[model samples]
Target: MTNWNATDLPDLTGRTAIVTGANSGLGIATTEALARAGARVVLAVRDPERGRAAARAVQGSTEVRRLDLADLASVREFAESWTGELDLLINNAGVMAIPESQTKDGFETQFGTNHLGHFALTNLLLPHVTGRVVTVSSGAHRRTKGIRFDNPNLTGEYSPWSAYAQSKLANLLFTLELQRRLAASGSPVRALAAHPGWAATNLQGRSGSAVLNKLMAIGNRFIAQDNHAGALPTLYAATQDLPGASYVGPDGPGEMRGGPALVGRTAAASDPAAAKRLWTLSEELTGVTFPAKVKTPK
Candidate 1:
């Protein structure tokens, strides 16, 4: 809690990390910081060229691998091709406020890529994961009332912002429920969540609204923090001695931009019933159930 920042990261000599969406923004910063700490970082990005460039920009051991969170097959392929123990799995890839669209698997875009995709990737790679699973949620989660399990895809009446809020909320729910299961199974692996607050990232440009993107660009210049600053909370969550289900974010006004600190989530994000329901739904949707060890508590 001493104004944790990237420079404070511990030496990760033998640690290995896989960071999704590592080509730019907070993902790139997280990847670079982890690499600088001596971790062999994998830049899991959708674009191989961009991933390679990003790998070049960083100053430590790094590799590039293609991963499209919107495509579950890509997620499985990445998981299947991995050959060793993983010390960190940073679920950092995501799209925000994008126009209504379905992933290759047909689920709504934001929920599919941000939550379900990471859900499948984490479970498939869970066996390889020896340390932690750090998922990136968003402060936008406060926008929605709660998860609508009955219509999680929002196929009925689609609002981009609403879908994004649900996806971010699902992120926290996934972290909490995953930790419960990991503890029940007596696994050493822990699940944690973090958010970058309002940072200038390519996520805004990909949302498919030119006007909104322009507005956000201007806002980023004036109000948002830089990507490196945004990545601090994630690095803190990944490296800090935090409990399972802990959430980290910036410490600035309204938790928007500053040093890293543990932040609060909406009450709806802590609903155990909703988390369980979403977990079951994720398993069914992805056809990737986590291996059972100790029975889940009733």
Candidate 2:
């Protein structure tokens, strides 16, 4: 899909989308584009006031919902309150390479929020999903070897970049397994992944290193694309008629910036065995399992 952009999104009338972390950065841009395309967009953020503020800027049917991916109780509450069909679920909220911290559930922050949180949420709401599930991954997934199953939380040793990379890799693997399950269940839903590829967002500022943050600030200005451009791949994956488990990213060099297109992932990300193992671990950690039957919306 050369030269494809958010402006090329199909008419999304009557659709409903929930974009986590929709209060800022690529999340907000994605919400705006989907709303502009006539979808009823939900700004799912941890902060209700800020979510409302973001929602006010959107032009279509919109609502603000509090959802803290770092907390499992909040995720369950959000999913329990849902009703009817959900056409799109954009798992966009995530923490980057920040200080090594634990989520409320005691899991590593990056893995907990970026992968497990969305993993639990998606399975909880799978029955209502009629269209697609798009989880935002990252090119940084290539930096790490694979999931640290022995000590996923990095209990004894923790590196910010490694944690982030593991979480991003989990994103792709989750998509892969989710699609496999959906297909096996004979469901119409699809699961896809996308990456912004060096998008200029406030996420870069919280790497927990002053020197690195400053360097990233400089790179954000020169090397990164704007939020709208960064959001193209997510939008494309969310709305396009692509294959299950497809990964979309920019078409530019190194997938840093350009139009949306199918992109490759590391072998670790493409391994079905690893995908299944991660899925099992995710369900065990979150206490959320894939639904035995997915109810399709008529």
Candidate 2 accuracy as lDDT: 0.94
lDDT for residue 220 in candidate 2, whole number 0-100: 94
**Each prediction's TM-score against the native?**
0.96, 0.98
Q: Model 2 over residues 208-290: C-alpha lDDT tens digits?
A: 78999999999999999999999999999998889999999999899998889999999999999999999999989999999
lDDT of 1 by residue, 13-129 (tens): 999999999999999999989999999999999999989987998999999998988899999999999988899999999999988999999999999999999999999888878
Instruction: Please list all clashing residue pairs in model 2, or write none if there are none.
Output: none
Minimal lDDT window, size 10, model 1: 289-298
TM-score for predicted model 2 compared with the true structure: 0.98
